[model samples]
Target: MHGYANPARFLRLAKLLTAPLLIGGGLLAVAVLAWALAAAPAERLQGDSVKILFVHVPTAWLAMGGWSAIAIASLSELVWRHPLAGVAARAVALPGAVFAALCLATGSLWGRPAWGTWWVWDGRLTSMLVLLFLYLAYIALADAATRDGQGQSRIPAIFGLVGAVNIPIIHYSVLWWNSLHQPPSITAGKSEMAAPFLIGLMASTLAFSLLFGGVVLARMRAILADTQAEARLRRRAMNAADV
Candidate 1:
């Protein structure tokens, strides 16, 4: 990982990997979504509403996973002082928030058909909503820190680490409280879904995860380049003043 601390090395790596990730992820996601929509059998209970699973579940996974990335990056910044740690955290915020919003939107759509309501204050939905708010807060705080020229503020990192506590609550909320949301259907070594549904879901998850990775790497490279440009401009100004 430290090998990536060198911005040049990281840029080369990001350049090499980003295209493949985007292309491959795009192809796979399209194929899986097509399959889910056109061929996958409707659930015996939920019927066509089950189709939303392909999109909703993956976005939800990415949403939580995004924060997990932020928390990990924050930890690295705080403990190991990884130079790109803040960059990684910043790269994650917008995309994570987008996915979280998508999760809520899709969940709402799914709920309207399945639960007879468009929104619910149930444990799972409520906690997931809170996760979205957390993402927004992190983005705002981190952006403010950057704009204030206090790039080294530990506030965002601290918040990232602390915000992670909500993750497990979001995961376990369905189990811990009475809710309209369904419990976990797929678990280690067993799945309640049929093979076709599982296959479609797994493919969708992999595709979106790859896309998320590509986006993060690309964002990191952009941030590094911008930072370098600013540093160069600063040095040039100082040199001119001295002359």
Candidate 2:
């Protein structure tokens, strides 16, 4: 993995792999969306509105998954000093934030019919909201630290590690409080969801995960190119000053 941290190596591999990744991700996304929205059975309670689960649940899952990736990458940057760790961490922030917002928005849309309100201060919802804010804060902190030349990698890396505390809080919120958001209906011990619904949920989860991976890879490549360009510019300026 560290060997691929070299920008040249990464670029070479990315160029080779880009077409396949794009094709696979696109196909999976389309297939999953079709299966989830069109083929899955309507819930006994929520009816067609349950189809929103295909989008909402997957976005929520990816939002957490993205943050976990950031936390792991940040840890690598701090401990292993991996050059690409910071890039990966920063690359994931925007998509994570967008997905977090999507999760909240879709949850609210689903809630209106189910919970009888557009918004609620319930434990799970509030914790998820905090997760969204954490994503925004991480992006803002990273952007500021980079622009001020106050050290780009270390500050945001530390912030990411610290902010990761929210992940557990969000996960356990339903268990710990009397929230409107129901506890996991598809638990290991008791599976309440029908087989078709569960299948759609799993497919959607896979599609979102693939989409997130492709997006992060694309963003990281762009960042590496920009960094290389900046270095070349600085070298040119130095050579001119010497002459």
Candidate number with greatest TM-score: 1
Q: Against the hidden reference, what TM-scores do the models get?
A: 0.97, 0.94
lDDT of 1 by residue, 120-169 (tens): 89888998899999999998998888878855458999999999998999
Candidate 2 local lDDT, residue 173 = 91
| Model 1 TM-score, all chains together | 0.97
Worst 10 residues of 1 by lDDT: 144-153
Stretches of model 2 off by over 4 angstroms after superposition: 150-152, 188-190
Over 4 Å off in model 1, which ranges?
150-152
For model 2, state the Cα shift of residue 14 in Å: 2.8
lDDT of 2: 0.86
RMSD of each: 1.1, 1.6
